[model samples]
Every structure is written in C-alpha cells, then in structure tokens.
Target: MSPRRRRTEEFTSYYGRPVLKEPTWEALDIAGYIFAGGLAGASSILAAGAQHTGRHRLERAAKLTALTAISASVVALVHDLGRPERFVNMLRVAKPTSPMSVGSWILSVYGPLAGASAAANVLGIFPRAGKAAGIGAGITGSAVATYTAVLVSDTAVPAWHDAHDVMPFVFAGSAAASAGGVAAALAPLAEGGPARRMAIAGAAVETAMSLTMERSGKLSAETFHQGRAGTLLRLSKGFTVGGAVGLALGGRSSRLVSTLSGLSVAAGSALLRFGVFEAGRASTRDPKYVVVPQRERLEQQGRGASDRQGAAAGADSMG
Candidate 1:
C-alpha cells in the first residue's frame, strides 16, 4: 500500500482575501493625476531656469506645459473623487501631518502662480509680476514633485511604506525627467541643450533610486517584480535608459531625435507611476506581505522577552 502524503501548512487570510485595504484609487484617474502633477511641478522649475537664463524657446514651452499639465492634473483629481465637492472641503482645514491636505494647499498655491506666469508671457500682461509668480511656482513646484511620495508612503501599503525613504527621490527625478522631455520635444534645437541634460540627470537619479528601493527591501521588494507591476517597472527602466541614450546622441541639432527621446522619457515616467501604484495593490492583495512581516515581528518580540527573562534569572541567582 502507498503511504499517505502529508501536505504543507498553507497561509490564508479571511476567505483568502487581502488582510489590508486595497487602494481605492482608480488607475487612470489617480495615475494620470500623479504623472501630470509631476510634469507640471518639474516644468515650472525648468521654466524658471529658462527665464533666468534668457532661453526664450525653452521658457515659453516650459511655462505653457506647466499650465496645461497642472490643469489636466486638477481635472484628474476631481474625476477621482466620489463626491467632487469633498475636494473643496479638503481646503477647509490644514493638517500638517496629512499629505493630502498639504498637497491641496500646494496645488492651490502653484496653480494660480503657474497660470499667471504663463498668461503673463502669452498675453504680455505683467512681465515683472509674472516672473515673480513663476519664481513662486518654481519654489512650490519641488513640493508638488515630492509630496505624492509621502502621501503614498504614509499609508499601510507595504511596497510604498517600505520604500518611503527613497520614494521622494524617485518621484522627484521622474518628474524632472518628464519635464525635461517636454522641453526637449517643444523647444528649438539650439535651445534644448539644458533640457537634454536635465533629462539625462533625472533619468540617472530615478534609475538609481528605484534600484536602491528594490534592493533595500529584499523579499518585500519582490512586489516590484512579481506580476504586472514587474512587467511595467522593467519596461519603464528600458525606456528610461533608451531615452537617456537618445538624448546623448541627439546633442543639440536633431529635432527628431530630441522628440523621440522626450517621448520615451515621458512614457517611462508615466509607466513608473503606474508600476508603483500597481505594486502597492499587489502588496495588499497577497497575504504573505501582511502575514510574514507580522510573524517576524512577533518572533522578534518573543526572542527579546526570552533574553530579558534569562538576564533577570541570572541576576537573581547572583543576588
């Protein structure tokens, strides 16, 4: 007679469902908002630099891009709200600890300044005032690029929370890359040198930060390379590398090359946002992510207690 086989213990959550709350954010609305907000924020910085440096083509493109991207980002955010009116309520109180509240304030401050800056340039309204507004936008723009990372990382999402230290840098670099891509695509060839340089620098930072994130978490970081998230992140890395290489090849003369490079970087930035969002969802979906960490913590507590008890017993014997 054949011996009966024993099965390994299986880990399960309630009805085999996630023990954590899956993010309620819709992919297109939230993901698109993240990409556009990043673009707007970084473009504002580029616009300010171009304005200061007297690069007319780059300044014009960056200013207009910032305005357009921020407007689109607002629409995406409103679209994601179940009750759009609740967005207005978000501004009623300030919560320093709350990223969402801080983000709302940042947008409010950045939006009008960005709009005024672009409008002043387009309509020749108030150059001095517009420049001042543009500067303000530039200052606030950095927060816009980074605050979203804090928003996601502050949550229970394992992938995001675990990578909190690097998330801001990752998002900031991606934002800069997207903005640089826009400038590269829209500005004249001679004026696009800074844009190309910015693209390369941003890509390098983003790639390095992302790699750091993946390597830092060991098993937990597997969320980045497991399924759909893995596929998108890998593709984002490929596009980022390709875009950077293209920018290097294009130099300052090839408009077509610049355009392709810009497009690739923009695509890569968007894919990275999508990848991170999807990774968070993946982390929540699997029980192991939730269970394993907790189990380890409990084991650690047990060992700590045992060590304390042993030390106390030894002290008592000595006494």
Candidate 2:
C-alpha cells in the first residue's frame, strides 16, 4: 500500500460563486491613475522644495512632471468612469467616510495647485504666487500619495481590504521613488543628488512594507504570489532591488548610472501599482479568498461568545 500523504486544504463557497464583486475598474486606466497620481504628488513636494531652495532647473522639471502626471491621472480617471459627465458632479458633494469623495476633493485642490505652479514657470509671471501654489501642492501631496490606499482598502476585496494598514505606506513610498526617479532622469546631474537620495529611501520603504504585508497578511497575501499578479510583483521586486543597488553603486558620481537607476525604479513603481490592482481583482474572483477569511472571523466570534457564556455561568454559580 502507498503511504498516506497530506492533502492541501481547500475552501468551498456558496453555490461556487465569488463572494465579492470584482472591481469594475479597468486595469490600464485605474492602475495608471494610481501610479501617475503618486508620481505627481511626490514630484510636487520635490518641486516646492527645489523652488524654495532656488534650484531653478530642478524646480521647473519637478513642477512640469507633477503637472503632466496629475493631468494624465485625471484623464485616466475620467475615462474609467465611462460617464464622463459624472466626473464633474463628483465635486458637488463631500463625504468624509467615502474615500472616493475625499480623493476627488484632494485632486481638485492638488491639480490646480500643480497646474498653477507649472504655469507660473512657463509664463514667467507671479513668482511669489507661484511659490505659494507650489507650497500648497506640496502640502496636499500627502493626500495624493496615499488616498488611493483608502480607496482600495475600503472595498470588499479581501487582499486589499486586509492590508489597509500597510497599503498607504506602500503606495506612498512607491510614489516618492517614482518622483525621485523622474527628477533624477530629467534634472541636471549636479542637481540630481536629492532625487537620488529620495529614490533610495523610497525604495527601501516600499520594499520593507511589501515584505511585511506578504509575511503578515495571512491568506490574503496569497493573491500577491499567484499567477499574473505574482509574476508582476516578482518583477517589481527585482526591478526595485536592481535600481537600489545601481543607485548605491553610482552614488552622486555617475549621472549615467543614476539615470538608469531612475528608470528601473520608475518601472518598478508602475509594476507595483499594476500588480496590486491585479491582485485585488484576483482576490475578488476567487471565492476562497473571500469565504475563508469570513469563516475565520465567524469562528473567532463564536469562540468569544462561548467564553463569555462560560464566564457568566461561573459568576452565577459563585453568587
């Protein structure tokens, strides 16, 4: 007789149907928006910093990148909506609990500030006013960097919803790296020092957060390591690692190496966003990803209830 072997566990779901509706968001549009918004947000901060420090070339490049990326992000978002007219109506109301509403408002405030900063550079007018707008963009930049995390985690998707605590940091770090990469690529070699440092720091943070999420996310983490999403995430990790190493080796001495590193980091950031989006979609499609976690939650609640009842019985007997 053959020796008995352990079988992998499988979870069943009601009627073999997905427990949650997959996001209606198109991968190209929504993922692009997420990546571009992050890059724009972080670049705005870099622009503001450069402007204050009187680094004209860096300021202009960062500001232009911010404006261009944000504008593209807005376009992607509107296109994803299908009913483009409703995009305008999004501004009509504000709901604190609604991440989407909050994100729209953040963009409204951020987009104009970024555009004004870029325009100020182009028109060579309102120097002080432009500085103020750049500062405002920098301030609102946090929202632009991390609000997408709120947007994704607020959903029913198990993988995304479970990793809410780390998602914002992941996105934030990725955004900063992407912006830094762009700055490194576009700014003069002499002015690229800060960008290089930012890229290195951001890459470190993003990699750490991703590793933590994968280790601590329980079953939800499985989505990040399976099929297409898995492939993309693995690629992102490799690119990020390679970029970080290149930056470290090149330091401030090699502009060519810095530029190449910047490209790698930017590509990694894009892949990270796309991979995350695909993972969330995969989580929704698989009934086990949804059902298993919920079943665990119910079991935990049952245990708590039983313990409470047992405590009550003991208290009555003592009385």
Candidate 3:
C-alpha cells in the first residue's frame, strides 16, 4: 500500500476572493491629481529660488506653472469627489489625523498664495505681499508634493502601506524633477542652469528611492514588478534617467536638447505616480500578498517568543 500523502492547505481567502477591497479611485483623475500637486508644490519652491537669483524668466515661468498646476489639481480632486460641495465640506473641520482633511486645508491655503504670487508677477501689483505669499507657498508646497504618499500609505493597501518608508522620498524627487523640467523647458538657456541641475538631482534621487522600495524583499514589493505596473515603472525609470543624462550632456549648450530632456522628465514623473497607484490597486486583488506577509510576521513573533523561553529555561538550570 502506498503511504497516504498529506494535503497542504493553500494560502487563500474565503470563496477565493481578495482579502481587501480594491480602491475605487479612477486612474486618470487620481493619478493626474498626484502629478499636478507635486508639480505645483515643487515649482513654487523653484520660483522662489529663481526670484532671489534674479532669473526673471525662470521665476515667471515657475510661478505661472505652479498656479496653473494647482488649479487643475483642485479641479480633478473636486471632480473625483463627485461634487464641488464635497470638497468644500472637508474644510469644515480640521483633523490632523486625517490625511484628507489636512490636505484639504493645505490646498485651500496654498491655492490663494500661489494665485497671489502669479497675479503679482503678471499684473505688477502688491510686490511685497506677493513676495511673502510666494515664500509661504514654498513652505507649504513642500508638504503638498509628498503628502499624497502619506495619504496613500496610511491606507490598508499592502503595496502602499509597505512602501511608507521610501514613498515620500520618491514623490518628492518626482516633484522636483517635474518642476525643474518644466522650468528648464520654458525659460531661456542662460536662466536654465539651475533647472537643469535640479532635474538631474531629482531624477537620481527618484530612481534610487524607487529601486530601494522595489528591492525591499517584502511580498508586497512584488506588486510593483508585475503586469501593467511593471511596464509603467520601467518606462518611468528609462525616461527619467535618459532625460537627466540629456540635460547633463547638452542642456547647457543647446536649447532644443534642453526642451526635449525637460519634457521627458515631466512625462517620467507622471508615469511614476500612475505606476505606483496601479501597483497599490493591483495588490488588493491578490490575497497572497496580504495573507503571506501576515503569516510570516506571526511566525517570526512565535519564533522569538520560543527563543526567549528557551533562554530562560537554560538560565534557571544554571542557577
């Protein structure tokens, strides 16, 4: 008689369904909002630098870009909420613990300040007020660029939550890359040196952080390298790196090269945001991504407790 084979239980959820609900966010609206918000936030900071350095063309371009990007982002956010009042309602209360509530207040304050800065630049009025507003916007814009990472990571989604440690740096780098890219493309060659440097530095940081997140060895990290998410992230890295190289090699001497490189960097930044969003959504569809990690954590804890008990027993025997 053949020995009876033991059946192994597979890791799965009840009825073969996912353990977590998939996020309902529309890809275009949410992804676009993330990209635009980052661009606006980083551009405001670049605008301040340009203003202080007397790079008038770069300053004007960055200020206008910040205003336009922020407005578009607000529109996307409102549309996603299904009604304008839904967005306004968020401002009725300030909840520091709630990313949505805090983001709402940040947007409200940053929007007017960005508008004032752009208006001052274009209309030639309230010079002093505009300077202060620009400074204030820069400070808040830094938060705007990276807070989406916190918002997404704060959720139950495996991919996003697991990436909380490196996600903010990824978003911040992408933001800087996009903002610098746009400024470089719009400003004259002579005024584009700072933008070029910014783009290069940002691209390097983004690529490094993304790699770190993907190579974290966590099961959730696998989601970033599968199917649609993988393709988008690959393209993002390629474009970002290629653009940075182009800027470094020829941006100083050739306006055409600078423009193309800048556009590539901006596109890469957008793709990075979309790729991350898709990865998080994909993770929710698979039960193993969630269940396996949880099981592993429990096993580790059990092992630790057993080791401590063994050590205590040994000490008692010695005594």
Candidate 4:
C-alpha cells in the first residue's frame, strides 16, 4: 500500500513478499551482461583466427583472450544473480518472458563451444592438438560473434526489441571489427587483407543500421539521443568510421596506423554494446517510452475496429 509499509512488510514473517529500495542496477536483465560477455569472447576467437598458418603466437594470445572473456562472462553472470548458486536452476524450466533464462541458455551453449575451441590452443605445444584447436576455433569463433544479438533482440526494451531485424548484423559487424583489429595487430601486410575487409564490412553495417534506426524508429532511437547514451552512440560511430578508413588504406606498412585503426574499431564496438545497454535501461526508466507508443497502437486498433463495424453495417443494409 505505502512505501514504508511495504518495506516493513517485506522483512515481516509474511511469505512471498518482495523487498523495497530496489538495487540501482541499471534495471538491466542478467541476459544483457551475458550477451556482452559472450560477444567479447566470440570477438577474441575471431581475432585468433586471422592467420591460418605460421602465427602460433598470435593464435595463442587470441586463445587466452577468448578463454578469459568466457570465464569473465560466466563470473559476471553469476554475480548478477540474487541467488548466485541457484543460477543453474534457470535450465530447469525456461520462462520465455525472462530474458535472463534465454541468456542463461545462450551462455551455456557458448561456454562449451568456446572451451572446446580453445582446447587445442591451450595444448599448443602439441602440434597436432593445436591444428585441431584451430579448426574448432573457426566454428566456435563465429558463434561467439553472433548469438548475443538474439539475446538482446528478444527483450522488450524498445531500442533492442525494435531493432531485431538488424541487430544480428550489427553484432556481427562489431565482432568482425574487433576481430579485424586483433588480426591487424598480429598479421603482416599481405595477410592483413581479410582483416581489413572485415573491418570495413563491420563498420559499414554498424553505421548503416545506426543511421537507419535513428531515422525510422523515434522511441527506439531516443535511447541513443538521451544523456550518456548519446555520447557513447556518437563515439561508436566516429571510431567505426575512422578504423574502417584506416583499414581500407592498407594499415600494413605503418604499424602505428594499423594499431590505431584496430584500437579504434575495438573501442567503437565496445561503445556500441555499452551504449545499447544504457539505451535499454533508459527506454524502461520512464513510463512514457513504454506507455505512449503502446497506447497509440491500441488507439489505432480501436479506429480500425470502428471502420470495420461501419463497413459491416453497410454490407447488412445492402443485403
């Protein structure tokens, strides 16, 4: 009934009562965290893959990066929970309404794939084993890059849910850019072609989707325009564009340029994730973003009903 009363009752002997003073946890579903971590892990795998041969050192570094990211992801996921130990309970019965449940499943799937992929890299001193790890890494690397888009899109957050059609591509692009950066850092000029191509492609996808989303979706785009979200969104664009241009110019001859571009792409991709995270929080922070558009949709439905009723009456009169 009342705030204080609710708090008093919360700690009472009563059962099934919830707590007051909600944690200022950005109101983010644990799914978001898992998704971010999963993407990071996937990106690392891609980075490890740029050279198909003669670059064991780079691959080794990439493997470690991927494993660390995956482990961090698992840790962040557990930390996000109220009952950390019961986190596995998520797999028992999935409630689709819960993003966290779906995310838990995604991470569960990605975790093993990443582990399997890195096994060979970890056993690198064993030449045959390393080759096997490379093959596994390629497949798992793609998964690491893509699945999080699904996780975010399934949410009710206006920015995220509304961007479902393009979200996957956006994520793919970001991962590619990140991976490309890793490649550029490690690969020689001749070997850098694929990574450069990936960087350009990723930047293009991110920029296009961002611009299209901004223009076509008002409420969804509002997430980017407001507060800190605006800053991150802008920064993501700038870095993506700059990095892509550098890659296009062939960053090989000048290590400095390559490094700068790679870092820029990585920064842009990270900003994109963090920005969208904030946007989702902002979308749900106030009632207007949620209520107004839904109300409008309802009103449109009412109008359509009225028109249908009138048309039906006219048909009856004609009969």
Candidate 5:
C-alpha cells in the first residue's frame, strides 16, 4: 500500500473570526479629517512661499483655504469622537509617545496660527503679526499634514503598520498636490507658476511612493489592490496622473484648463486618503494578513537557532 499522504492544514482563526479587531473609525469622518488636515497644512506652506514671492492673490487664496480646511478637519475629528468634550479632554495630559495626544496638541497650536494668519490677511491689519503667524502655521502645518500617516501606521492594522516606512511620504505628497491644485485653480494664471510646479512634483512623488508600497510583496500589500480599496486607488492614480499631464501641457496657456486639471488632482488626493483608510479596515477582516507574517517570522527564527546549534556542536567536537 502507498504511504498515506499528509494533508496541509489551512490557517483558520477561532470561530472563523478576524484575528484583529477592525478600527471603529467612520469612513467619512476619519478619511475626510485626513484629507482636510493635509490640504490645510500644505496650503499654509504654499501661502507663506507665495507671500515672499509677491504673489498676493495666491497667498491670500492659500491662506483662506488653509484656514477653512483646518476648521473642517477639526469638526470632523470632534464628530468622530462623538462629543466635543472628548476632543478637549485629550488636552488634559500630554503623552509624547501617543500619536493621538501629539496630534491633538498639533491641531491646537496650528488652528490658532492659521486663524490668525487668515484673519490678518482678510482684514488687512496686523501685517507683521499675520506674517509671523503665517510662518508659524507653515511650520506646524507640515506636522499636521503628515502626522495622520504616523497615527495610522502606529496601529496594529496589517496594511497600515506594514507600510509605515512609505506612508508619511505618500501623505505628504498627496497634501502638496491638493494644496497646489487648489491654489493654482483659484489664483491668476500669471501667479500660478509655482503652484503648477508643486502640483506636478507632488503627483509624481505620490504615485511613486504608492507603487513602492504596493510592491512590498507582503500579504498585507494585497489588501491595497483588492476589492473596494483597489477600485478607489486605481481611480486616484488615473486622475492624479491625468491632471499632472494637463497642467504641464496647457496650464500656462489657459485658465479653464488649469482649473479643471487642479480640481482633478485635488479629487485624486481625497480618493487616495479614503482608499488607504479602507485598505486598513479590510486587512483587519482577514486572518491571513496577521497570521502569515507572524508564522514566517517564527519559522525564520527556528531555522536560525537550529543552524547556530549545529555550528556549536561541530565546534565542540573539533575541540
């Protein structure tokens, strides 16, 4: 009789449930907060640069945009927490190791600076103080734009945690692209050169980093390219690339083209944020994303230990 063949057991969780609990964040609230924060942060930086360059219209538009976006982001955050006091309560203690704590502090500081800058610009008062506030906002705005990536990556979600190395860059690029697009669409063509350049560069970086992340060859990476997340990401890539091309080819010659292209890029950035959020949520529903990586790590450790033991045994025998 032939030897009985051993069956390979498939990985399964207790009661076929997910190994990790999915995040309870609402898609609209959390993803919108992410998009708005990035837009606000990048707009502040662009506004500061435009001011120094004598692009008054662009600077004013960017400042207002930053203020509005940040305000919306705060509202979304508060809504997600289910109570306004919950957000304020986060300020009761400062925990440097906690991303949520740090993010709350960042929002607190950035919000006032952004508001001050926008108010001074619109009212044409406190010119020097407004400039200072704009500068401060620009500095903190960077942290605001990229901190969400850190916050998400710090979680136990396989998709977000595994891509920590590239997530910040992706978020930063998306922020710049969206900010630049909005500024370019709103500002006069004569003053939009810088905005156009920023949009193009940001789109390139966003696309490259996203591709690098998807190609990481980990089981978690598959979450990005399957189901609803995949569809959203694919559409985002198309819009971003198409918008950049349109800006490069016709942005200088026509206002309509520039506006359309800028809007496209902004839309793409928003979609990307939603897609990333969805991917993390989807990863938590699958046990393989959590189990396979842990198993692989243990197997590697086992092989290394065995090799070390054999080497030690050989050395003792020779002695």
Candidate 6:
C-alpha cells in the first residue's frame, strides 16, 4: 500500500486470470444508469445555475427534469439489482472500495436533495435550497455519472477499464446535454437562455470527448465501431448533431423546432449511454480487447516504469 514503493507483481489489471473467459455487463443495463445519473445531476446544475442567474422558469423545468431522472434512475438501479426487493441490502454494509455502496449512498442523499429542490420549485416553497440543494445534487450527479465508469472498470470489462477517465467526461457531457434538451423543449426559448446554452455546451463537449476517445490508441475506440455498438454510437451522433444544429438556428420562434431539437438531444444522450455500455460489454466478450491492449500496457510497464511517474506520463501522453 506504500505509494513510494514499487511492486511489479501487483495486479494492475486482469488479463491472465483463470476465473473467467471474458468479463462484461449488459450495455442497456450500464447505460441506463449513466442516463439516469447524468440526467439527475444535469437537472440539478441547470436548476441551480438558472436560479443563480435569476431564471425561475428555467429553474423549475430543470428541477422537474432532475426529479424525473432521479426517479427513473432509482428504478433502473433497483431493476438492475438481481434481487430488486433486497436492493436495500446494499446499505447493510458500507465499503468505500465498492462503487455500488458508495453510489447507493450518493443516490440516497441526492434523491432527497433533488426532491426537496423540485418541491421548492413548486408550491412556491423555499427557494434558498435551490443553490444549496443544487450544489449537493451536482456532486451526487457527478458521482452518478462517473461511478458507472468505476463500476465497469473495476470488473474485467476491457472497454470500460481502459477508457475510465474519458468515460466520466462523456457521461457528464451527455447528461448535461440531455437535461438541457429537456429544458429547451419544455420552456420557451426566450426564457430558456440558460438551458439553451447549457444544452449546446454540454452536447459539444460530449461529441468532442467521444470523438477523441474513439481516436485514442490506448482507449482503442475501434472496438466500439462495429455491430450493435456501432449502430448505437451512430444513432447518438446523429441525434446529437441534429439537436445541436437545431439549437444553432433560432429555435425560439418555432415551438415545434425547439421541442424536436430538445428531443433529439435527450435521445442522443440516452443512446450514448447504451452505446458505451454495449461497447464495454462487447469488448469484454472479445478476449482480444482485454489481452491485446493490457498486454501492451504490461509490456510497456515491464520496461522502465514507476507507478506514479508512469501514470503521470501516461496521462500526458493521452492528453
């Protein structure tokens, strides 16, 4: 556990393990969580951001999106649990190393915060929590967005593990874009300036990050370029592009255009989750995805390496 010490025998990743042929999780399952978590956080941030800039309509729409996303995410998380009725069993023990336990705790906190914020938006309740609760919601939202990366990475899943850093940003941007889209659709454009900006910005970030990761040699985005994964990725790209273009025009004048545009963003966001999730699983299904790059890393590590120094250097290389 010493940070300074070096140990070559320590397991950096699972490659030669005998317990499993290949490791993977269902794409839909994984992406569903990504979508929910992202939506929740994005909504909260949009809501708080609106309130800070003094936009009540924007704030309300954002909170509603957050509330709805939190609700669906809760359901999806539980549904993914093998025993839905015993999903609470996760809380029986708390372990920091276990992302689920940590995420569960985060969700527990965020649920209430999101709920309170939404209620405040309605009933003309306490507006003070808008910022306070939003801050908490955003923190938890990020966790929700990125924890899926940790979850998938911790497993023997090749695609997920390799793209850990990039994945978080992808989910974050996608979520923000999705929530922003919803705000755009539900609110009038004139009143939806903040949401419009957030949606555009978030979508741009998501598209850019995804493209970079797809091109990165280390992350090996090629695994995601084929079959069902490819289809989903393409769908996400199309929707995102369409949404962004629509927003570029003065969508404010035409309610139909604004609504459709927002819908496209939301759709793209959801597809992003599905695509990444499937890609990870698909990578897991193919032993090559794991054995190839991992062996490449180990081979690199076997030759002149320091855990800290190497990681930092790798970070720069990837950047």
| Candidate that scores best on lDDT | 5
Off by over 4 Å in 4: 1-58, 82-84, 92-102, 125-134
Q: Give the higher-lDDT candidate: 2 or 5.
A: 5
User: Against the true structure, what is each candidate's TM-score?
Assistant: 0.94, 0.95, 0.95, 0.78, 0.96, 0.82
Of the candidates numbered 2 and 5, which has the greater TM-score value?
Answer: 5
lDDT of 5 by residue, 1-319 (tens): 3111121136777898999999999999999999999999999999999988889999999999999999999999999999999999999999999999999999999999999999999999999999999999999999999999999999999999999999999999999999998988998999999899988998999999999998888779988999999999999999999999999999989999999999888999999999999999999998888887797789899999999999999999999
Give lDDT per model, in order: 0.89, 0.88, 0.92, 0.66, 0.93, 0.76
Clashing pairs in 6: none
Residue-level lDDT tens digits of model 6 in 30-113: 567668778878788787777778787888888888888888877766666756766688778889989878877888888998
Model 3, residue 113: displacement in angstroms?
0.5
Please list the residue runs of candidate 3 whose C-alpha ends up more than 4 Å from where it truly belongs after superposition: 1-10
Give the lDDT of residue 131 in candidate 1.
Answer: 96
Candidate 5 clashes between residue pairs 3 or more apart in a chain or in different chains: none
- Name the better of 3 and 5 by TM-score: 5
RMSD of 4: 8.1
Could you tell me which 10 consecutive residues in candidate 5 have the lowest summed lDDT?
A: 1-10
What's the CA error at residue 35 for candidate 4, in Å?
7.4
lDDT of 2 by residue, 1-319 (tens): 2111111155556777887888888998999999999999999989888988888998998999999999999999999988777888999999998999999999999999999989998899998899999999999987898899889999888889889999999999999989988888788888877788888889999999987877774777888999899999999988887897898788477878888988899899999999999999998887877666667779899999999999999999999
Each candidate's clash count: 0, 0, 0, 0, 0, 0
Task: Give a tens-digit lDDT track for model 4, residues 1-319.
Answer: 8543353334332243322222245323443453346445555555445436655555554555566666766676667666666678888877777666765665676566556556755654555655565555556556656767777777667777777887777777777776666566655655666666766787788788777765665555677778888888899999989888887785857877887887788778778777777776676655455555665689899999999999999999999
Model 3: per-residue lDDT, tens digit, 87-192? Answer: 9999999999999999999999999999999999889999999888888888899988989989999999999999999999999999999999988899999999
TM-score of 1: 0.94
lDDT tens digits by residue: candidate 1, 152-261: 89988889988999999999999999999879989998888888888889999989999899788544688898898999999999998899899888747688989999
What's model 3's TM-score? 0.95
Better candidate by lDDT, 3 or 6: 3
Task: Give the CA lDDT, 0 to 100, for residue 154 in model 5.
Answer: 98
